[model samples]
Target: MLFNKEYYSKAFEYLLESTTYLIIGGILAVVFGLLILEYHTIWSDNWTVLITVIGWIALFKGILLLVFPKSFNRFKYLFKSKGFINFLTVFIILFGCLFIYFGFFSY
Candidate 1:
């Protein structure tokens, strides 16, 4: 889906059109974030800090989606921008590489 622009755009459109789906997704994100934080709240180490940050970001993103679903409409324009998509793809690739390095070689 990430590599397919048409599919990606359609999926984004579907999510934007379906309010119920957004609400449900937001609820799930909140629940998952809370659960993550519940067990890994301390930021004592790199892994703990990363987990805590992810939890916090998830919690905030869910809240934003729930409270301002309409605001996300602005992002629809971004999905159409090839530059933005390229940037996102590069970022995801780099992030994945870092994750692999940390998970395997860093140890």
Candidate 2:
């Protein structure tokens, strides 16, 4: 494939930013899962299944983010607006928190 410096640069920046959030989310999810496994007496039978699924899905997504580096390049334009970028960041964080919470507490 032909290289476009501009495109690749933008893509790299966005991918880096998004991947950071993804990593943070992954860590949070894992920690929450561990917490549930350690202290919670509820859902002992199925907790393993739910935690395994969530952990696997998050790990898969994190690997995909690192492997497919171009998926987020199109978001470059969206970052131009400060409000939009903040909104997107907050939305992503909220989504991650909710995902972790559900994975831990939903059973």
Candidate 3:
């Protein structure tokens, strides 16, 4: 669903609009990647491993985006459904908020 090329025309344009954005994104990628990579290494941890893989992917994407700023331009048309995209965006935000809440208060 998210892989649809129609949705990427200007996806990271805002975040990768300038050298400052690239630098910031790169820093975040390194931190997020290390933290995620450090947290899960065992294959037995399926879900965690999945997330770790995502982290690594994020790191790689971030690095690539920073190094070759024009590369991400290719992702501009992966998806085009603004309605579904907006829905998914909201879902993700809510899901993240729930996680934050659970992380702090689940115990």
| Candidate number achieving the greatest lDDT relative to the actual structure | 1
**Global Cα RMSD, each model:** 1.9, 10.4, 5.9
Give Cα-based local distance difference scores for all models: 0.80, 0.57, 0.63
- Residue range 28-78, candidate 3, lDDT tens digits: 887788777787555653334556667788778767766886665454343
lDDT string, candidate 1, 1-107, tens digits: 36786767667777876778888878988998899888889877575487789899999988987997777777877777777767877888888888788789987
Comparison by lDDT, 1 against 3, better one: 1
lDDT of candidate model 3 versus the reference: 0.63
Root mean square deviation (Cα) for candidate 3: 5.9
Q: Order of candidates by lDDT, top first?
A: 1, 3, 2
- For model 1, name the residue pairs that clash: none
Those runs of model 2 whose alpha carbons end farther than 4 Å from true positions after fitting are 1-75
Give one digit per residue, the lDDT tens place, for model 2 in 36-99: 5455434455434555555555556555555654565566666555556556567778877877
Q: lDDT winner between 2 and 3, please give it.
A: 3
Q: Each model's TM-score, in the order given?
A: 0.83, 0.33, 0.56
Pairs with backbone N, CA or C atoms under 3 Å apart (clashes), candidate 2: none
